[model samples]
Target: MWHIYQFPLCPFSRKVRLLMAEKGIAYELQSARPWEGEDRFFAMNPAGCTPVIKDPDRNIVLSDSRAICEYFEETVDRNPQISGTAQQRAEIRRLVAMFDENFFRDVSGPLLHERMKKRLVLRQSPDAKALREAMKLAHDYLDYVDWLIDNRPWLAGSTMSLADLTAAAQISVADYLGGIDWTTHEQARAWYLVMKSRPSFQPLLSERMEVIQPPSHYAEVDA
Candidate 1:
């Protein structure tokens, strides 16, 4: 059996979980809090990150979402998320990087730090200024998604890929944090609704992170 060490709301972990579910890979969740700095967790992964996957039978221990995803991509022949021609694969990676790095930096990371980390981990009040900044940047990111939806079926190109999973993971977290405002983003909202309606997304929507809760619309597929 494969076991994944991850937190409920970690977007990168969510990305891996989505990919695993979409690809029909079986894995059990082993909840972890990297921020807590547990000795066992650090011993398993020196970097101390969530989304670590271990296969005891195979003696395989993998950390880092990208590395884990790519490992499965190479090992599994079916349900290729990074499929198609060389150019198409490149496009997928490009968009994946854009969401994983830029979007996280500008939106999801800040919201997580303010709304989740501050409240749960730090036991401190969220800074209104930082919260406002994250929400404002979320609009910008969603605006870009709206434009992308206008141009392509998915973020990268025609078929669903890692790009979709990555963006959906980030957006789901941001939306959960109430950092997203989909009121004016019709196209983006429609795109995300499709994502939310997927079978792989259902578990994520239903799961909670301790005391904090998402907005009512967060789990509603039609919303």
Candidate 2:
């Protein structure tokens, strides 16, 4: 069986988990906290990140959400997340990059680092300045998401792709931290409602950390 080492609220981990669930692939979920920098985990992934998968059957170990998702996209054909023509696939990749890199750097990454990881895992005081900067940047990021879904059916194009999964993963984590203002971004909220309603996303919504409780509306897509 495939085994994926992940943190319950990690966006990168959620991305891979959502993609696997969407494809109807079954795997064992091995929880890990990369921040501890354990020796065993380091042997698996020197970079010390969650969302690393070990495929015993295939004799392969994979790290990095993008690389893992692309590997699955190529090997598993049951449900293609990157489906479409060449140009459409390119667009999907572009948006996925935006969420995983740009949006992450400017918004979710800092927020999660300050509000969630610092308090819960690192046992350090939250950085107020970083949190404030993240909150402000998140507004602009959500506005862009709102604009993207204004016309298109999905973030990248007509169909759901890695872009949507990546986006929802990041946004869901932020929402869990009470960082999102859903009422202010109507289109983005609508899009997220659909994403949240999917069976693939149900598990993520149900996840709760012992150290931190999510907001009341965290699991409510309708809210």
Candidate 3:
């Protein structure tokens, strides 16, 4: 059995979920919120990050989200291939790393830590400066995305890969939080619209937060 410890809102967790769905893999989903400080979770992963996977057969515990995705790509042979050629695989890894490092820090981090922090923690006020900075960073990131999509059909290359999934997960969360302005980035927005319509993407669209509601357009796959 494959068991995944994850937080629903985490982009990293979302990427694994998407990959699982795309591969038609049936895994057990265990909600493990690192923010709540679970001892066993920390023992499994010292970093206490979400999206930790335990494979019973291998008796292996996978901590990092990217590592888990790569593990799946290598170990599983079902569905559309995510890691294509050597060059394609390298590009996917590069793009995934880029999204995880630069995009997450610049776009998703501040938006979640600032604008949505108050929602998650009552009595806290939104950080206007952080939100402004995140918005600027998101815009800058979109420019890079524009360049990517303009050149290639997908973020890494012609074929859809984990790179697209990683980027989509981040953008989807930002969209849920109303941190993205679609009109400003038409190319990226159009690419996202197509991704949001996929069967693997539906679960994420239907995700509802107890304390926060997504914009109407969020659930609209065509949007």
Which prediction has the highest lDDT against the true structure?
Answer: 1
Error of model 1, residue 43, in angstroms: 2.0
TM-score attained by model 2: 0.95
lDDT of 2 at 190: 88
User: In model 2, where do residues sit more than 4 Å from their true spots?
Assistant: none
Please give the clash total of every predicted structure, in order.
0, 0, 0
TM-score of each: 0.97, 0.95, 0.92
User: Which pairs clash in model 1?
Assistant: none
Clashing pairs in model 3, backbone N/Cα/C closer than 3 A: none
Off by over 4 Å in 3: 56-59, 121-123
Model 1 Cα shift for residue 117 (angstroms) = 1.0
lDDT per residue as tens, model 1, 1-223: 8899998889999999999998899999998999999999998899898888999999988998888888888988778889899999999888888888999999999999999999988999999999999999889889998999999998888988999999999999999998998999999999999999999999999999999999999999986
TM-score winner between 2 and 3, please give it. Answer: 2
Query: Residues 30-99, candidate 3, lDDT per residue (tens digit)?
Result: 8786766779889999987888999889898998997888788777888654667888878788888888
Measured by TM-score, the strongest candidate is 1
